[model samples]
Target: MSTDTSTAAAAGTQPGGGTAVQGHPGRLKPRASRPRRGPASYATVSAVAVFVLAFLAPFLIILVNAFKTSADYRSHGTLSLPSSWNWGILQDVWQRVDFTQKLLNSVETSLGVVVIAVVLALFNGYALGIGRIRWRTAFLVFFLGVNVLPQEGLVYPVYYLFKELGLYDSKLGYTLLVGVTYSAFGTYLLSSVYASFPRELIEAASLDGAGRWTILWRVILPMSWPTLSVMCIFFFVWSWNEFLYPLVLLISNENQTVPLGLAGMQGQYTSDPTAMSAAALLGVIPMVVFFLLFQRSLTRGLTAGAVK
Candidate 1:
């Protein structure tokens, strides 16, 4: 009996241990400790704060200076507050810029572009995304051509075409031109988002007797709200801030976009620096509002597949 007991002890004992320690069969093993916040986290936060302040400083300067008169602005340092909040300067700029008209023109043009571009891109992206047509490769190649081709090269040709078609000063002409120009690149971008969609979802929809258009509108468009929001903001910003196209296409003051209208602030004899700053602030506010409004959607789109 003693020899049997000794043999059992020897079998149970680990080589490094004096005696075998039994664990509770039902109890889970303790996991390793997690890492605590350390130097790297603090360093990253501090760097981000510094970068944020640096970028905000210029915007602060613009905001403060927009309220000053040209004389007050020149007399006082840029960083200093004005003696008084000069409401007069804002009024002067509002009138001089014809800012209300310019704002309306910008909104109209942006919406028009958005409506047209999104429609065309949805069709293109849908065809390439799920249809799996033989022309998918050809379509991508064609869009690549449009995106890579410098708009500068097409300027003269488009200008002549518009002139011949009597679309030179028409808003419809500009709207169509900008819309078509955006479609190819927009389709290319949205296609990636579409590709990231689940093949299973598409198959399920089809099995339920959902047509292509039904699946696109019901399943795909709803799921792709983030990408669509981002695209809307992107297109709106580009169209609002576009200077070259307006400079070339819009000959009349009545048809000018905001950027071109703001550029008109630089006069032959005298420049109203305060008005210029104010006008610029006005121009930028829409874009800032747009970004802030759709920021969450953009963030969701960007981080969608990051976690698998």
Candidate 2:
């Protein structure tokens, strides 16, 4: 027993070393050290903060200048605060923008595009990805073609076609055009979701006498919600922020979207810089709110797609 005690002490073992040490049996161990964020880590953080501030500066300038009087803005520059806080300019800008009419037009048109695009995507993705559709490769190629073809190349023809149909200045025509244009993108995105679908589950469902429609409605849709949410976020942002289409197509205030209405702040000779800034600031608020609300959905959708 005395020899054993002497041996344990010489070996740097615990006093009651009957079993074994975790890392090296019968030996004492060093305590684990926590990792410290060094200069490299702090440099990365500093770089990120600088990048964020660079992007945020323009938004801050816009917000600050939006409240100033036109003269004050022109004199003091974008970075300076207003001498007199004219809070009522927003109310004036709101009316000038035809807020109610423009807002309604934007929402309706975006919703129309979303509905049309989502429906087209769902049906086409189902047929090509899951159904026994003939010439599936051809369908895939066609979808890819539509997406790759630059809208600029076909603008003249599309405009002529719409002109013949008396849809040159109509919101409905614009909605259909935008929807069809974006549907190709949506179909391609959703095809990936359908392609990765569980084959065994589909076979089992079929064996249970469940039809394709039932399988799609019950299984595919529920599983594909994350992808759908991602699509909605993209399509919504695109539709809301569309400028060129609405600019050319919407000729009047009654039918013009928010972007077009905001553009009206500029006159050929003189423009209200402050009012334009105010309108632009107001226009961005809804989209910002929307992104904030759906940020979690967007994150989850992206992560899910990445993992798959």
Candidate 3:
């Protein structure tokens, strides 16, 4: 009887007593929520940071060293700030390097290259990208073949050909060569961009009694501004930075573009670090400025209509 009473009390106490055990669902732990940083977002930020550092670091090195004397420059790390600023170096560079003339030449060459290349590329790319023709495959393959042909192999042939045609050592010759060399790849790049544009827009333009040339100029060119801007920057950069062709073709220092001018500076001073640094800095300044100005177009314009 006593045992039965104890058992009943134990059973009753299980639910009410603080230390009593009872079968109950374990209190669900509020799961600690994982912080959200979606993979793509993280990747994008990382890529941008990397790109910025890669571009800025070299230019920063130039800026820092541009102010240092040869002794200080040699002793210090390339990235280190100068011990003392020398504004006179820049002044000397400007006067001695004929920087004004060289800069103007570069501007003219780059602008001419950009304009001529893009104009021809627009027509050719539009035709090839949108136009259906029997020889389209053959023509594209041929252009690609031209692109693939070793540039070195072509240089001698081009030099000889230009000499025969009375085109060597002339600005006109350089402009023409740059334009032609660029067209094949420009056409190829623009073709990809043109392909992604809305077909319906083209059809509508065609239905409105527009001729192919008119449609291309009026509709296609305007719509392709993003890619066109990108191409302009690209061509300008390439023409400005071109060393080999300018070195080979430009016989006269007076006709020399900035890259050639920089090379000439090297010989003029026999590797005087101060002058060389100044010339190097001066040569790169315009391009760096141009790049910064067009940074928005290059990044934004690349993806303008890509999604839909």
Give stretches of model 2 more than 4 Å off: 1-28, 306-308
Decide which is better by lDDT, 2 or 3: 2
Q: Compose the digit string of candidate 2's lDDT tens values, residues 1-308.
A: 88987787666675674433666665556556799999999999999999999998878877887889978987888788988888999999998778889999999999899989988998888877888478877777888899889767877787889889999989999999999889998887777668778899899989999998999898788888888888888998899999888877778779999888887888899887788888889898989998899999999988986775
Estimate the overall C-alpha local distance difference test score of candidate 1: 0.82
Candidate 2 least-lDDT 10 residues: 17-26
Report every candidate's CA lDDT.
Answer: 0.82, 0.85, 0.79
Task: Give TM-scores for every candidate, taking all chains together and pairing residue i with residue i.
Answer: 0.83, 0.88, 0.79
| Ordered list by lDDT, greatest first | 2, 1, 3
- Please give the lDDT score at residue 210 for candidate 3: 91
| Cα misplacement distance, residue 228 of candidate 1 (Å) | 1.5
TM-score of 3: 0.79
Q: What is the lDDT of residue 246 in candidate 1?
A: 76
Among these predictions, the greatest lDDT belongs to: 2
Candidate 1 residue-pair clash tally: 0
Best by TM-score: 2
**Stronger candidate by TM-score (2 vs 3):** 2
